[model samples]
Target: MSDNPKPTVEGGSDLPGWEWDRTVEDSEAVAVGDSVTFSKDITDDDVVRFAEASGDTNPLHLEDDYAAETRFGGRIAHGMLVGGLISAALARFPGTVVYLSQDFEFKGPVRIGDRATAEVEVADTLDGGRYQLSTQVLVDDEVVIDGEAIVLIDEAP
Candidate 1:
């Protein structure tokens, strides 16, 4: 057998080998007020890809003409796709983390070509190893989504 493993995802690169560390614990108490922010330029390709991956093909998301007739005036991204960017922020930070729950409120429509940035802050620690994470998704400094996330982390024993 060849030494290389088959790529499991499209557009995947083969560089950077994976190493397994068995001793890492999976729980922690994230400090309150700690925050993480991340930004990405939204593109039509991004919207299409998210729609394909998420199976959300509402005309408001995929059809510009249909969207233009709506109150939003043009294609708007799926709210969950915008909220999902917060997961990128969390992943970029240090921790062994797992999502417990999310409460999202869509405040405004996100149109194509709008750069979306997500800011997440450690809100409060709850009982049973859960932490409340407050998140905001902004497009060009305009708040589009506001939400709270509950996550569990592995604290060192």
Candidate 2:
């Protein structure tokens, strides 16, 4: 992680539909040692829609009986579905963001009606203009999944 603290906007970067500018000079700041958390409740409809849209019809996420037989003992949401929300947050933040890679570790099952929170912390900065962010998804204060994401932001134009 590079220790340089200056924020600049790249013109004509690789990210599509994004114009990087220093509109929010502190947008990228991680407050030295603070973490940023974004949370939302998971509804049954959310799970069903995600399953339908992603074409992942795993019975464990839809069939209660089948899910009950599993270790979770109930239906759970698709891991990527919860992950997608984190991606959405990163994209909406004030910057030209590009997801480079992600490493996810599912800690527990995420059931419908559980309020999940996604937290991100600026972990490191690479020399190649990439940001390594520490991310996690939690339910009822229990971390359901955690991972690290690599994002690239270049000058727009």
Candidate 3:
């Protein structure tokens, strides 16, 4: 949302190889057009761990042979797993970001080992410290998921 982007925070994650950047310096200044980006690479361990945690052990995401036969041509990451990146982006916001609702359209497949970047932009200011954000996840500079989310940003207590 910011044309002149400034790095409010960089390499904010404690996890290895994870990174984030916030366009606005003040996280408490939740306004229309504020944006944040979070990036990480999807790895084999991530997929297996996500499957074990979420119970979404679909063969297309886990079985290379099965996935190769499908239209995707190879194993692909879970859609929701990639969508979760949007939440990762929101967490970089200046306050406690609570999600009320989110809706997503999976436009394309995200292969394992791809670097996924989630971008969240505050599209509109809502009543009661809430905001509507446009959320997107991209792999290789191609949008793989697009969505909208409503979140309540509460002051850090």
Candidate 4:
């Protein structure tokens, strides 16, 4: 969400392999048809960093042997970690997007290294520049997470 054309890390270096797209060219004209999609590979580093940052060291997401014994049969990315992609999509909106709230139902597992894509579309425009959006994350065309979100899109200062 910085004014940079590409997402950057702490050093202002571009985040490798991260890509996004939006249907609306004029970010100022956000409407029901406005939509954005963000894609990136959920790497091993992503899982570990997320686990450390979120304090969700669930064995299913960290301990390979322990995960191997479970129904997933291997380590899977944390549900919230995958859900965070929705936030990524929202950040691409033209304005200074302020997240209001989000609800998610994780539908499947995303293994480390899976290319996860999150798509969000404006479903309705509310009063005061707020929007209700339909949100979902997919892996290989399979919906791994489904949900909705509300956000306030404010003008860039």
Give every collision pair in model 1: 26-154, 27-153, 27-154, 27-155, 28-153, 28-154, 28-155
lDDT string for model 4 (36-134, tens) is 998999999999999999999998999999999999999999999999999988878877899999998989999999999999999999998899999
Best by TM-score: 4
The 10-residue segment with the lowest total lDDT in model 1: 17-26
User: Against the hidden reference, what TM-scores do the models get?
Assistant: 0.76, 0.74, 0.90, 0.93
Ranking by TM-score: 4, 3, 1, 2
Best by lDDT: 4
Runs of candidate 1 with Cα error greater than 4 angstroms are 1-29, 155-157
TM-score for predicted model 3 compared with the true structure: 0.90
Write down the RMSD of all candidates, one decimal each. Answer: 7.7, 8.5, 4.1, 2.5
Select the stronger candidate by lDDT from 1 and 3: 3
Q: CA lDDT, every prediction?
A: 0.71, 0.69, 0.87, 0.89
lDDT of 4 at 154: 87
- Return the lDDT, model 2, position 107: 93
lDDT tens digits by residue: candidate 1, 31-138:
777666767666788789998998889999899789999998989878888888787666544555679888888899887777788888888978876679898889
For model 3, how does the per-residue alpha-carbon lDDT over 61-115 read when each residue is reduced to its tens digit? 9999999999999999999899998988887787678999999999999999999
Task: State the local distance difference test value for candidate 4.
Answer: 0.89
Q: lDDT winner between 2 and 4, please give it.
A: 4
